[model samples]
Target: MSERVADSTIKGFLYQFNKTILEIVNADDEDVITVEGVVEDVDVLSASGELEAIQCKYHETKEKFIPSLIFKPLLQMAEAYDRNPSARIKYTIFIYVPNEDHCQKDIDPSILNSALATTDQSLSKIVSRISGKFDKVEFLKNTRIVFGPSLDEIECSTKAALELLGIQGSDVDTLLYPNSIEKIAKLSSIKDETERQITKAKLYTYLSSATHTAISKWTLALRNRSEILKNIKQQLSSYFSQNSRDRYFYIDKNEIDDYEEKVVVFFGNYIKKYYSKPSHVTAPTFIINDNIEAIRDLEFRLYTKGIKANTGLVGNSFVVDHFFRDPMKKINRNHIEEREFDLRLLAMDSEQEAINHRKGDDLYLVCSNTPNNIELTDVNFYQVGISSFNELEYVIGIRNSHE
Candidate 1:
């Protein structure tokens, strides 16, 4: 027969076999339902009083086979069984092959056919292979089936076995139990940790870039103090005292100093908010090198013009502020000094060491002790300037030098 014809014949025989089994088992009034268009060659439902669900299968092909159609129904039955413990509905699967020789040559017919035989030698073998092997419940050992027959004889043989067993079907379990909340909780915890790490990484990148930009802008503004003072004055006018009798004016230096202090405070707050804890040190190792070198070059330029720039170690590293100061120029000197008074960078071997120092001081920069002088507070310190020793040959001037 053609493959299609063989499949159709096998399906018809399976349906007849299913009907016989249902009749022998005395299935429920609505339990002998037929499901069409299923991929399986034959599917049987027996919801009789004693039996929960039974599936029948017949293979016409010579190829070795195991029926996969029963897997879903078996799972459904197991779930139903779990819900109604008192429901004494048993599951059975029957597979009928042509004969012993036919079964040996093709599929391991013993796997599904064990239930029908008088002696359970074949069933015991299949059970041994399954017991303690899978995490889920094992297939029912109560299954049985008769060996093969031609299309005409298969249904009769199946009916004979069903009558001999005195099978009776009842209501099969229908409810599918939900998964436990503990499993979902574990998965959710894993997802939460992943998201937290992602957020921290993103925040770190944002804060690092913002700090770099702020430093760049501050350096540029310090270079052109007069223009920055003009801008600050213009911006601050709206906030100034507007009384006609009391005319309030801001000094250029004071305005510039206030702007610089604001920038410092902004950097401090940004670091506190996003980078409160020292994360993995992925930033460049030699960040201070270029800035230190630039300071040295500026000192050299001043030295070439016969100007002596006094440089001293404030906290640990040599100060570069002296080289940038112009004696004839004066803007916001008091405010600038006040903002720098407490701000000092301590040289450290690694970022971890720097973090450790900051942690000891509650993540704040500390200043070197100056004898007989009040310590500066409410300021910020940033590490800047070139980092090379070769650039140190250009030492020139110093700012706020009372000594």
Candidate 2:
């Protein structure tokens, strides 16, 4: 039973995420949303300097609204009000109501007073925390209960909200949900409260201007390789470009057979597509994600194929200039991520070279089923999961007819 996933965490994350999106879309230009706010799960600061503090909850198992479920949250809000009595704060509970038949006035002033003012031993400590600090009447008057849709229903509502903001054609799943959720998760992770907040304008810009770039390392780990690959193909196929982008290939030498052979095939095809038969396409840089030995082995393999890759620890003096007629698509002498080889004498500083020749236009993290930790060189990139050498060829559109 424990192993069976109910996806409760995912539901909660998407619910909060959808709510944040809706809030940003509906908010005035000056209103800003503070993710994982001090007062509640979300806080909306308005142009008039008022705060709309919201606590969001998604409980699919619960049959209906229950005052006791909100015991701790209400107490926390009451305490917040007590601490800053002068602040204009409006408390709201954004919760998934089990059904419409649930109690209508579930959180009226009288109901809140009855629930919070209780002397029940179980809730005595909770009541004690905010006891006599905030005016019960004032708190109740400002507080309200908002029933939300079921977990399944939230997506449609969120999509409707997104549609209002001009998103169309693409699946909302690939574009906004993870992107916005990723943004919120990043913002909330910051300890500085002010820094964690985003204005509606800035957030709208982020959501609209940026394309799908969900290379979340853990999310990648969680998904089945096929599902992730499916999503990757779907997303990347829509905006496929091989120019000015860096292709990062991450292969755990332990996961596959004849890894070097397959990698060479990947390289050959990559070169064939972009550089060998040029049709206005700029040759994208390649970064082999491996330890020194593996990279050295790849260098040796490519060497046999008469392809000189700048990857190394393979004993050989190197140069930055394309003097030896090195393949244009081969790794640069000063590529930042790979480990330095002993004989591959690089005259340039790797980090500065990386910065100077930024692969910021396009990027990728193509990896095997279990590659090393894939750190995105840039925030925007596509991830392709390759199971076999054949699949690697297929993903890069180099699957030979004979194979």
Best by TM-score: 2
Residue range 1-403, candidate 1, lDDT tens digits: 9979855663644443343333324434444322220212123234443443445455555454344433333443334444553544544434444443323122233423333221446434433444333323233432233334444454344334333432233111100000111111122234233331112123223323332111111222222323322332333233222211111111111123233333234223322322222221111111111244443443355455433233224454554443122223222533221111111222222111332211111111111111122122432222112111111111101111111
Q: Which residue pairs clash in candidate 2?
A: 313-341
Model 2, 125-179: lDDT tens per residue? 7667675656877777787777777755766676676667665554555555555
Error of 2 at 193 (Å): 2.6
- Superposed model 2: Cα runs more than 4 Å off: 1-6, 100-132, 167-178, 213-235, 238-246, 249-311, 314-361, 365-403
Which candidate should be chosen as best, given lDDT against the real structure? 2
Per-prediction count of colliding residue pairs? 29, 1
C-alpha local distance difference test of each model: 0.29, 0.59
